[model samples]
Target: MTVPTLSALATQLTSYNPDSLSVADAQQLIRDYVQATDSSETVGLNDALCRVLSEDVISPINVPAHDNSAMDGYAFRGSDLGVEAVMFKVVGTAFAGHKHEGPVNTGECVRIMTGAVMPADCDTVVPQELVTSASEASMTLAPGVVRPGDNRRLKGEDLMAGKSALRKGKTLHAADLGLLASLGIGQIPVQRRLRVAVFSTGDELRNIGEHLDEGCIYDSNRYTIRAMLTRLGCDVLDMGIVKDDRESLEAALRTACESADAIVTSGGVSVGEADFTREMMAKLGEVAFWKLAMRPGRPMAFGRIASNGKSAYLFGLPGNPVAVMVTFYFFARDALLRMMGGTKDSTPLIQAASQTAIRKKPGRTEYQRGILSMDANGNPQVRVTGSQGSGILRSMSEANCMIILHHEQGNVNAGDPVNVVLFDGLC
Candidate 1:
C-alpha cells in the first residue's frame, strides 16, 4: 500500500473527521506526527538527573548487595525465637556503611544498624526499639514477633545483577539518583535539552518596569512563556517583545530561526487588523494557521522556521494570558517535548465530576478553569472558578485544572462528569 505523504495528510485533516475528536484524539495525533529528535550523549552523574536516559541502565550487582537489616536492631536466626534475646553473644558489630566480613556462628547474633549486611546465619531482624540493650555485645528481646525476613532487605531482592534497571527513555528523578549512586554509575547517556525561543507581539504591550501608557499592559506572555519553557527542560532564549510592525517582527523571527530549535509567540495569531503573523509566516515557510474549534485559544498558528541546513518550529498562540496557557498546554508544550527527544509528551489525565453547574454556548470546545478538591474516596471533585472569560488572568491563578467541556455540549449541571486536566504535572 502507498503511504500517504504529509501533504495528503494535511488535505485529509482540512476536512477533519469531525467525529468530534476528544482531547485524547488530538494528543495521539501529535504523538504520531512528531518523533523525538534530540541527540544523546554521556554526561556525569551529577548532571544526569532529570535528563532523559538514552539507554537502559543495567545493574552490575544486586541492590543491598547482600541480605541486610532495614532497621537498627538485632540480626538473629528466626528459629531461635523464644530465648530472652537469648544470651547470644554479639559476635560482631555491623555498622551501615561498614559490614563485618564473616558469618555469625549458630546460636550467636550481631548488633546490626540499618543497612548493615545481615549475618549469613541470620534470617530476621528485631527492632532496636523492641529490645533492651543489656550490654554492647547483646540485647534482651521482647516477645510477640512472628516471622522470618522481618525488617530485612534480602540480597538481590530490590534489584538483580545484569538485569535491566531503568530503561531507555526514563526521565531521572531524585529517587533515581539514589539508585544510580548505589550502582556507582559515574556517568549516563542522556538526551540533549531543547532550545526554545520565546517572544510576543502587540504595540499595546509594554515591558515590565516600563511606565505604562494608556491601554498598555506589561508584556507578560513572553516571560510566562519563557518560564514555562524552562520548566519543560528547554534552554530558553528571551527574544524579548517586538511591535506589530513587519520589520521588527521579521527581524525577531529571523533571530529566533537562526538561533533556536523552536520559537513561541503570543498575539498576531488572531484575525484582526493588527495581526501580522499570518503574512510574515507565509513569507518564511509553510505555516498552518488553524481555526481550532476551541474557545479562548481557537486561533493557533504552527509551522517550520527554516534556514540554511537547519529548521525550527513556530507556535503563535493567542495573546490573552489564559488563552496563552491553555494553548501552550494543549499544543506547543507536548510537541516541543517530543521534538526534544523526551519520552512522554502528554500530561496525565483523569475524570472528575463537576461540583457546580456550567452554561456553555454550543460549537466551541471550552476549558473552564477550576479548582479540584478530593472527596472522601480520593477522587477529584472539581468546582469551576469565577469568570470563564479568556481575558481573565485572575481565574487562571485561582484554578488548578482546566475542566474541559466538549464541543456542541451545553448546560452541564452539577454532578456531571467532566475532564479535568491537572496543571501541576506537565513538566
Candidate 2:
C-alpha cells in the first residue's frame, strides 16, 4: 500500500484525540514514538552526563571493600570493654587510605581514621573526642558518649557483592560518576545520543552580521531552539536559517534527515502566502499540523520525512519567537527527549500561589509569562510579566516562570491557588 502524506499520517495519529488532549495523552504519544526508534551502544562515561544508562552495572566488589572507621577514633573490641571506662593499648595506627594488618587484642586498641580498615578482632571504634588519649600500649574511653558501634562501618553494609549498583535506564549525573568511581569503575556503557538538525524559515528573518531590514528581525529562534535541544541531550545539527524558497528549505531538511535522527524547525508552518514549510512537508513526508488550544503557541506540526530509506521526524513550530520557545518546551521538547530514550512524566505543571490579580477569559489554556517569588511565609507566589502576546520574546526573557491558566477559567483574585510552570529557575 502506498504510504500516506505527512499531513495524512498526522491526522491518523491525532484521530484518537484532537482538542484539549490531556498531558498524559501527549506523553504517551512521545513514548510511542520513542519505542519506534532504534537503539545503539556507545562508550560514554565522561561525556555521558545527563544521558541514560544502556545497561545495568553490577558491583565488581563490595563498597568500602572492608570494615573501616567512620571517624578519627580508636578501634577496639567491644566485648573487651567493661561497664566503666574501657582500657586498651594502642598497638598500631591506621589513617584514611591506609590500613594495618596488625590485630587488636582484647586489651589492645588501634588508632583508626575515617576510611581506615578496622584491625582484626576490633568490633567498634571510639572517636578520639570521646577518648582520653591514643597510645601504643592502651587507650582509655571517656565516661560518657561514643556508643559501642559508633564510628564503625561494617563490611558490605552499604553495597554487597554481586548486587546491582546502578540500574538500566538511569540517567547519569555528576554524582553517578562518583558512585561508579567508588565501585572502581572508570568507564560505562551509555546509549548513543540522537543527532538532530535545527532550523528556522522565513524571508523576514535575518542572521547575525547582516544588517536588519525594516520588515526583518534577527534570528532568535535558532539559538533558543539549539539551547533547548542541548538540554535534552541531542546532538544538534544547526542548519541555520533558510529563505522562503522551497528548494532551499527542502535541501536543508533532506540533509538533516540523511545525517541526523530528527529535524526541528520553527516558523513557516503557519498559513501565509510565502510559507513554504507546509508545501515542503507535503512533498517530502507525512506531516501533521495542529492548531493547539494554547496562547503564544498554537500551530504545532510533527511528522517524518524520509531520505534514502532513513527518516527523521520533523517538528514545525510557530514563527513568533516567544511562541516558538513555549511550543518547543511543551510539545517538541518531550518528543525529542523520547527519541533519545527519555520518558516525560506529564505535561509541565508547577506549584505556586498567585501573588497579584490575574484577569482572563479562557476558551483555551493560557501560559502567562510570570515571575515567581517567595512570600513572607516562604510560600512560592507568582505574578504575570506584563504582556502575554506571542510575539513578545522579551516577556519570556523577562519572566522565569509560566502561570498555566486552565481553560474554562475566569479572572483570579490574589492568593488563589494556581498552577504554574517553573522554567530556568526564574520562579
Candidate 3:
C-alpha cells in the first residue's frame, strides 16, 4: 500500500493548519499518511505473542477431525428416548484417545469418556452423573435428562477446513496460540518489530546522575518515553539529551532519520525563543507545526524527514512532563502502531459517572487524570486528581484512567457521564 504524503493528507483534513486543527483531524491525518512496514518473517508459535500477522491464516484441516463425546456419559440413539425412565445395554467402554468400533443397535449404548470419538449410530449422550441406576452391562437414565444431539461435539465445530481463522494485521495473544495449535500450525509469518529513536532537547535538562546546576532539571521525558515505547514492543534508541543549539539539534535529527523508522523528541516544538527544534525540522524535511486545540499538549510537530536518502516519520512533542506523555499516548501511539502493521485503533472509551462537578471550557479538548473506583452502589465513578497542571507528572502515575473531555464539550456536573480510557486490561 502507498503511504500518503503529508501534503496529500493535509488537504483532506477539515482544518490542516495548526491554528485551526481539531483532535479528530490530527488523528485522521496520521491514519491517512502512515502505512504498514513491508518486512516480515516466520516464527515459531512460542515467539509470536504480540507480533502482528502478515497474512491471513486459513485452517488446513477440520478441528477435532471427527465427532467426539463432550462428556463422560452413555452414548445412545436420540430416537429411543421416551417420557419414562429407560435402560440400555452397555455394549462397550470408550476411553479418551480410543474409540468404540462396534455398531450400537436398538436399546444399546456405549460408556464414553470425554474427548472419545462418538459411535457411528449414537446421536446424544446422558452424563454419567444423571443416570438413575447402573450395572456392569446396563444403565438407566431418568426422563427429560437430555435432548437430541446434546453433549455431542460435531466435527469441525471449532474451526472448519479451508476457512479463515485469523486475519492479517492481527496482534497475536495467548488464546490465539491455542487456536493455532488446534489447527496444527507450528510456525507463522509475522511483521518485524518497529524501531523508534527517542530523545529530549533542552538546555536546562541534565542526566539523572549529574549535579543540579542553578536552573537545570533532571531529564525525565526521555526515560518516560523510552519505557512507554518498550512496553509497546518497539526497539528503542535513546539519543540522550541534545543540547539546545542548532548544530547539535541538526546532528541528532539526521542520525535518527537514518537509523529509525520513527523519531520522537520532547522540549523543542513549542513557541519559546530557544525552541530551535522546529527550525531544524523545517530545514531537513517537510513538517507541519501545529497548535493543537487541546489542553496540556497544544504545541506539536508532525511530518516526515529524510537524511542521506533514508526517511522517517517525526513526532515533536511538548516540553512539560505530563504534556509529553499525553501527546505520545493520544497521537504518536496510533502512528507507531500503524507503522508496525497493526490495524487496530485506540482502545475503546468507557463511560462512567463523575463524582464531582468538573470545570471545563467548550473550545479545546481536555485530558484530565482520573481515578476510577466503585461507588456506594457498585457503579464505576471517576474523579479528577488534584491540580490539573501540565507539569504534574504525579497525576498520571497516581491515576488509573484519563478522563477525555471532547473538543465541543462544556462543563460536567456531578453525576454526569464522562468518557474515559483505561490504562490496564486483562491479558
Candidate 4:
C-alpha cells in the first residue's frame, strides 16, 4: 500500500492547520494515514491471547455435533403430552457420550442424562424434577408442565458447520480462545505483534538508579510508556533516555526508524531552548509540529520518519509526565493499534455526573484525572483528582477515569453531565 505524505493528508483535511490543530482533526489525520501491517503468523490457541486475527475462523463442524438433552430428564415425543396426567414407560437409559441403541416409540421414553443425545422420535424432554411421580419402570408428568422442545438442545444450535465463528481484525481474548477451542481449532493465524521503540528526551532527565543532580528528575515517561505498550501486546524496544542534543537525538531516531514500526518520544516537542527532539525528527522524517487545541498536551509532533530507506511513524509527545500519558492515550494509542493490525478500537466514553463544579474554557479540550464511583443511587459520579497539573503523575495514578471537557464546552456546574473514559477499559 502507498503511504500518503503529511502534506497530502493535510490537503485532504480542509481544517488542517498543523500549528493550531484540533484534537479531532489530529486524530483523523493519523487514522487516515496509518494502515495495518499485513504480516501474520500462526499461533497456538493458548498463545493467541490479545493478538489480532488475520483471517476469519470457520467452524468445521457443528458445535454440539448432534441433537442432545439439555438436562437429566425423560425424552419422549411431544405429541404424547395431553391435558391430563400422562405416564411414560421408561424403555432405556442414556448417558452422556452414550447413545440409546433403539428408537423411542409412542408412550415410551428414555431416561437421558445431560448432554446425552436425544433418541430419534423424541422432540421434548421433561426434567427429572418436573416429573410428578416415578416408579421402577415408568414416570408420570403433570399436565401443562412443559411445552414441545423444552429442555432439548438442537444440533448446530450454538454454532453451525462451515460458519464463521470469529471475524478477521478481532483482538483475541480468553473467551475467544474458548470459542476457537469449541470449534476444534488448535492453531490460527494472527497478525504479528507491533514493534514500538520508546524513549524520553531531556538533558536533565536521569534514568532510575542514577543519582539525580540538582534540578534534574528521573525519567518516568519511558517506564509508563513501556507499561502501556505491554498492555497493548506490543513488542517494546526501550531505547532509554536520549540527551537534549542534535547528534544523540538524530542517532536515536534513525535507529528506531530502522528497527521498529513506530517510535514514541516524550519531551522536546514543546518550544524550549534545549529541545532538540523536534529538530531531529524534522531532519530525519517528514514530521509535523502542532499546537493542539487541548490542555496539558498542546504541543506535539507527528508524521512518518525515515532512516536508511526504512520508515516508521513518530509521535513526539509533551515533556510533562501527565501530558505524555494523556496524549498517548488519546492519540498515539489508536494509531499504534491500527499499525498492530487491529480494527478501530476506540475506548468508549460514558456520561457521568460531576460531583463538583469545574472551571473550564471553551476552545480547547481538557482531560482531567478523576475518581469515578457509584452514588447512593448507583449512578456513576466523578470528581477530579486533586491538582490537575500536567506534571502531577500522582493524579493519574489516583484516577480511575478521565473526565473529558470537550472543545466548545463551557464550565461544568455541580451535578451536570460530563463525558468520562475509564482507565480500566483503555487497555
Can you give the TM-score per candidate against the true fold?
0.87, 0.86, 0.95, 0.96
Tens digits of per-residue lDDT for model 1, 1-427: 3533334445555345433333444444545555676588889888776678888999998886888888887888887777344556688788987877787776677888998887777888888777755577666665565366688898889899999888887878888878988888889888888788888899998888999999999987887788788777778888777889889988888888888888899999877987898788878876655677777787777777576666677888898988898888888887887776667645667689888889887767888898999989997799989888888888988888888887768878898888888888552
In candidate 1, the residue pairs with backbone N, CA or C atoms under 3 Å apart (3 or more residues apart, or in different chains) clash, namely: none
Query: Candidate 3 residues 1-427, lDDT tens each?
Result: 5666677778877666677578889988877887778899999999888888899999999987889999999999999899999999999998888889889998999999999999989989889999999987999988899998999999999889999999998888899999999999989999988889999999999999899999999998998899888777788999999999999999999999999999999999888888999999999998877889999899999888999999899999999999999999989988888898988665999899999999999988999999999988989999999899999999989989999999999999999999999977310
lDDT of each model, Cα atoms only?
Answer: 0.78, 0.76, 0.90, 0.91
Q: Candidate 4: minimum summed lDDT over ten consecutive residues — where?
A: 280-289
TM-score of 3: 0.95
Task: Show where candidate 1 strays beyond 4 Å.
Answer: 1-6, 11-26, 81-90, 101-103, 131-144, 361-364, 375-379, 407-409
Q: Alpha carbon lDDT of residue 276, candidate 2?
A: 84
Query: Which ranges in model 4 have alpha carbons more than 4 Å from their true place?
Result: none
Top of the candidates by TM-score: 4
- For model 3, how big is the CA root-mean-square deviation? 1.9
* TM-score, cand. 1: 0.87
Q: In candidate 2, how many Å is residue 86 off? A: 3.6
Q: Is candidate 2 or candidate 4 better by lDDT?
A: 4
TM-score-based ranking: 4, 3, 1, 2
